[model samples]
Target: MTAGTGLIPVHKTDNINKLKSLFPALVHYGNSDMLPMHMPGHKRRADFMGGIGKYDITEIDGFDDLHHPGGILKEAMAAAADLYESDVTYFLVNGSTCGILAAIAAVTKPREKILIVRNCHKAVINAVTLRELDPVYVYPKKCGSLGVTGSVDPEEIRQALAKEKDIRAVVMTSPTYEGVASDIAAIAVLAHNRGIPLIVDAAHGAHFRFGADFPAAALDCGADLVVESLHKTLPSLTQTALLHVKSTLVDDGEVAHQLQIFQSSSPSYLLLASITQCLALMAQDGAKMMATYSENLCSLRQALDRLATVTLLRQETGFFDYDPGKIVFGVEGYGGRDIAALLQSDFHVETEMAAPRYLLAMTSVCDTKETLLRFQTALSRLCHGLPPRKAVSFPNMETVAAEKVMTPAAVRERTWAKRDFRESSHCVAAENLYLYPPGTPLVVAGERISPEIITAIQAYVEMGFMVHGVNDRQLFVVSENMSG
Candidate 1:
């Protein structure tokens, strides 16, 4: 992430057009590109979509099946595997949720333990609940400036593995939502030495494989199972993702079996086709495309660096490593959401996500140089002669600890009852409480919530932050009448 006048400038060319020949699904729609009257119920109105309803297909004769891919779908998956350098890669229309769930279920059984970085997405929590797994949580190093979370410490994983016995798997999110990347190579070695597969939720890292300017993909770093959601950082349609199997520790057959159960029986052909076309574009044009993207990002960062009261997060900020594609900027005094609203209402630019301390702008290869410049220009105008808001920082949440009363699966079966928020302390939780953006849980199912945890939850609520799992100032806890 370069700054100052050293920003690499992108040279745009008008003749550059999207490669039209790569889309097989679009080709399957036949000559009439306007041919409609399909099953999607859009009724083939060109004005409704430009004939997108024609592309929304199911597993028809030659289109290929998601559960049993044999023809074009198999070829597409094979191409993706080769491109990603994985032993095998599956096309996931169900997003990274299906991949994470399948990867966890394939490698572990009910009641087994998995060591996971605490900053993982809520999807991991859902998986832990469904599999009834025991979790050993390792918290990340929190950023002190705004109390936001940072990358996982490889040493933390080593210590957790040494202390925990009968561990079936290890899971962590590399290049976290804040763009902090842990030492995947070191973490993978730690898990491999213990004969446990490491599952990396690289959902925000789909564009990582395009260049070394970004952190290396978890698959390239020896992770047994890695999941990437292309929609997050790539040009694919929403819900498109890929699951890569690298090490021999993960059973490929089991991954397939679990995917069959987890994903929809009828997957969307449009998403699959988009994945294929995206892979082809990246495979053929990614090197040049990424170079242009980095150039634009560098220009944006350079302009952003000139702001007096705003700070751009970088490697010198005590992070292990960072992804430049994620622009996490903080104001001297204002909250991130305030800055976000300012941009939205005044500048009409909606950002990806914002925390108390930072607002995230997800730059992609598809963003033009003009868009990047416009963002920088907006910042300059917004910051010029503006007074700083009051300096306010939330407390680091590492101390909000909970005790394990039972496995998440065990908690799922306990007939749940409601209790008022204030009296919920020391009670086993029947639900997970967390905030979005960085969806790591403040509390998960089957844990005994502490007074500190309750205080943090209340404080977040008072701050006007949305805290899931509380229904009208009440929470679900293990019913006292239920059998142990």
Candidate 2:
């Protein structure tokens, strides 16, 4: 008999005996005659929303509690730790956001300095604000043509550590949304030498362990604390994430304690079961799955490489490495938005993100050759149809590096007013403004807004890209009287 009873079909016969996760237990409990008097009001009613309600359960007897796990849940996390080779692992149902918040809070005291990459996700900024930590910025090398931030240089981390004596932790994102990975091993060494814990937001790198073609996982790269979004690159339910502790420099107990404060009390069993099923499948058949996936990706890349105008981003000079799964393509004459629109309207294909210079097509292990072929076909047609290459006006991305005037924590609580972006030059921004797909803030709160920022925002908006934190051409700026 086969184990999987969910949406994903498991065909590998070898996985029959190897499957070890909480998912089968959930199915058994769901099938049992046991009546429910638990917190979930659904009460195992399969008719509520298909058969999903049957598996959606609360922390019942053998299922174990997520917060104070001692039984099945604990073992499940341990299996994940063993798979990822981490000393300790915790399942995060609240997504990587909660993990980032907890990891930052656990490591440093209030107002303690931490070095953070400028191109880090918004969650990193939120963690700094929540923990009231002082953040010193380290910027990533830029891919000049694409206008996208690439790898964080190890030299930058070394220089920052030498300069900031009080820095307790170093935080960065590897395998950026566009799949640009940094040299995590070298960065980890620099931080460990200073006795500072290295925390990596590897949200897009959950699948790195499965394939040799992918860049190295941060857990294997000597990071003290690493957070991965299983749902991002792996076959798991949305919001499923994992936090791993690798070194003695980090207190695993404190991370567990912080998770208690940040993670949800009533964790969704359906999501946990999804995580279990994902882990089990990967444990059993991951090598085969990745092999097939890599083959398909390679074929698509070969086809894409033949296109004259559209350029596929593979290996570049600045980043340590690149993930082949992220299919980023762009032409000099046409904006990413232009190509994205054509893909949607003409080909009925949707991409992950449309940047000013490139459109991102995110692929996972689930992407079949047929689907990839369809995308390749669409892109090739679009490439042939696009007008001859000519320069198009794009944002001057260098202006995004705004100067910080106040701490994020201080500015977050201050009174604020919405002002026009055009006249808000030199004003302290009260809210995070960023492009949604890649949520690196253009201007975090406390940063003095530059005219170039205003210009960039307008250009992004004009190019048919969504710029968050703008309310009908207005931006939230700290009120004059609230200035410290």
Candidate 3:
């Protein structure tokens, strides 16, 4: 028997599909009579990798390489570009992390200034550190009682661009972890006026293009480079993402080169197949699915609105626009951790994330009406059962931009000491410290740790939030001798 011939066959569909290329090619190779001699030592065997081994291929003949896509992979990427209306799109098996890194590196040279939205994902910070780019900050506006950051004002971008004449590129995250989106069209215009290319880390907003109910995709909003995680809001395997290049300002060759640097050489064909399948499904039936999903979310919101203590956060004044899929619920007098724990322990429903004042539940087109109703019922039960207790006001973290003492690269060369987070006041941090779910650094490396930052960390810790980069409640700061 050929390698994995004994495995149960995947079901076949006769109907013609849209954006169909890579998946079919992989499957064809898997079921062929060819002998087993490939780099993937599994050799299409379903022994250890389960059924996935059958399609888990390497850069074999006809499969086409991810880095140098000239065959089926090229066609698949082209189809995705068409679907997304980008000039060119590349599949990212390494997820949005590599995409963000590649995009930032492609557009800016080392030590060049790149204006960054301060509340960006930690990957952006990593990109700045890796490329050694000098980052100028533009913090997002605060909205609502949840203390979640809102959109970056276009005016702020305009001001930063006008002030920082040496800035090479601009980077921002749209539809933050809490689902608030910036005015990308306006911001893109502001960046372009200064001849700077805008790179939007739209990892959480991948589904925006699939439905009218969602915010506009950053690519369509005129961003030069847009990186999206297909897995975040779509039905794709984890670590699958897409990087789109739409403007002449960004060099496609440079982007490809940087992606080769950041992404693994042996990209997983299984993940590629997952991306192909997801895109095909989206191209075919995504609009209908998104419509139904939007309707269900609305109904769920209406049900949630009836709760006396529980409040569902929606688009309010000062917020540009919010993604409907992010379900943020807040109950007075209760920490978000408590709500999330009750949902997990009592109702068996795990939420996406929890902050000081609010718990976030992420919904996608994959969620069914039954699932939404169950979540709604769980919230209703929890909200009714809990009594009103003393509430702690959430600090306005949006206003607390840490003092930048040095570049992240410079901080890496210094001696570090671990100090109790509370006692670490006024010390320059040697590492990033931020909440885990959002991963936005409250105090990035090379920044002075102020008392306000310490208080914020203590508050989050007291409310049971996971603080990353802290060991045993100790934060890494520049050693006392190096403090000068």
Candidate 4:
């Protein structure tokens, strides 16, 4: 597998010409105006600029509606569903967050019990609030050395479901924020045996379906519902995603209704069209492209593994399989935030996520060999003169307990309200409160804030990380008007 040969095959002149033809359709599709813009104020103005003005289109006659996609948009979604081998697929213009919300709402009824992994995205928490559903929280396996969340153990899920016999569904995140994948197949079987549906937040695993050597996708592992963020790892525009329904546990009508409840009425035709184009590209040549990408990732990892002061995380460290495209490296002596700043300021390289100990860099099929090599070169230079890092103490696992304050449905009725941080210490939270990069909430609404949570919040603030759901930059409290 040479650099520009097998995996990264050079596109023939004809292939390039075919790709060029797509531009005109995208441009012409933008000009099919039906009426004056009542939604997005842009109105196709030149001042809006770039792809925004050209693609920021609304629902019109010729353009099939989003909610009731019976025409071109539906056809596009069907094509994507076929590619993924799913029973049905819906185009999500509001990112995977909306898909997650819809999936939770579709699977569980109000006040029904659900088993959810604690490391799930805030969107899942929001679903719990909206449905007023009771959740039995399952903690992810902990990596003491890295202070990072690992995959959820199958046994834990089994125990939680057993304890809560009425659990309507189980939701988990495969290939977590740090790119750690779980035994999704085993968990799916467990859920199915208990007559419960399994919903997987595979937002970071969209590319898993493409590569043969990659970890199994949620849908392939028997999950009933899988939500993927196409833009995260694929060459699609941001906020373009797919929601796949695979089992009879969830009806198509219920899922569709939930989608309508959560999704925007006037969806972006540009985003919908991009989903089609991305799926087409993936169906045609995804395997070949991903093979090349995997080869590059292996090469890049090997190069980074040899660095003295930096430790590149791999599956062998009791942490299971990882997404090769996600390059997570720990700077031995320096803080991750400081290293990220240095890379951005001095080396002109920006990373995806930065924590106290490690930084993440996401690679895609679009990444060039030169680009990766450049990142490696910058890293080597940065590590040359770094000082010894202080040993930072992270909170113990026992301190972070799941406290159920209200059902999912009840939490939803309380609109997200903002208050002063100083006044919010004891208030019930209405929104997710956590750091942006990792997006983990320390205190969800309905749960009282413990000293440990306050400590975590203070640590984040001291590290220059922004803490959401706080009032006046001092303390964070939950919203006052919370549902029962």
lDDT of 3: 0.85
Greater-lDDT candidate between 1 and 4: 1
lDDT of each: 0.80, 0.85, 0.85, 0.76
Itemize residue pairs with steric clashes in candidate 3. none
Error of 2 at 207 (Å): 0.9
- The TM-score of predicted model 4 comes to 0.87
Question: For candidate 1, lDDT tens digit of each residue in 1-484?
Answer: 6222111112212211332222555555644454454555665455667866655655656777888888777777777777777888998989998999999999999878999898888899899888888899988867734455777788889999999878899999987887777778899999999999999999988888776577777787889999999988888989999999988898899999999999998887778878877877877777678878888887888888889888887754546667788888888788778888888888988898877777888788899999988888887788784586766766445545478788778887779999987899899998888887667788888889898988887877776788888878899999878888
Which should have the higher lDDT, number 3 or number 4?
3
Across residues 211-322, which tens digit of lDDT does each residue of candidate 4 receive?
8656778898899999999999898889988899999788978999999988888777667777777876876788888887888888898989888777776664545566
Q: How close is every model to the real structure, measured as TM-score?
A: 0.91, 0.94, 0.93, 0.87
Candidate 2 lDDT, 187-260, residue by residue in tens = 99999899889999999988888786778788888888999999999999999999999998988889989999
Q: After superposition, how far is residue 258 of candidate 2 from its true place, in Å?
A: 0.8
How do the residues 197-251 of candidate 3 rate in per-residue lDDT, one tens digit apiece? 9999999988888777788888988999999999999999999999999998989
Cα error, residue 25 of model 3, in Å, equals 3.8
